[model samples]
Target: MEHRIRLAGPAEAAPELACLRVIARLPSHWSVEILECGTGYAILGLRTRVPAEEAVARIDEAIAVLPLLGWRRD
Candidate 1:
């Protein structure tokens, strides 16, 4: 199954990219894709055999620490 998190605008992309990089390296049985949705929007695609809720929880955990990395949405 695949789950995606769509983030709008360039403002969120940098940190999201950074965070997602870590997510991509995490110990998971999932595959991650970074997709450019448009001029300013992006998508974080997660393909996993895990449950949907588990994927969401992992994504949420990554987002939760985003601010600590010095990136915040404008």
Candidate 2:
């Protein structure tokens, strides 16, 4: 499953990038792609063998704790 998450602001780029880097370095069931979109960045999240909703929930849980990286899911 893959999800494209739109960030709330450009200020989130640094912390989000840092967090994604850490996630990439660890053993995981998922992969994330960060791309610059004008002033902000977008995240493309992919998880194999997981339901689409579950993958989204996992990403939501990860982003919820971040002060600035959270975005509106709707």
Best by TM-score: 1
- Each candidate structure's TM-score, on Cα atoms with residue i matched to residue i, is 0.59, 0.54
Predicted candidate 1 versus true structure: per-residue lDDT over 1-74, tens digit per residue:
88776644444456445545546544476787775444445577778888878876666555446443443222
Lowest summed lDDT window (length 10), candidate 2:
65-74
Model 2 agreement with the true structure over 22-63: per-residue lDDT tens digits: 345433756666543433445454546777777667656656
Clash tally for model 2: 0
Please list the residue runs of candidate 1 whose C-alpha ends up more than 4 Å from where it truly belongs after superposition. 8-16, 22-25, 37-41, 66-74
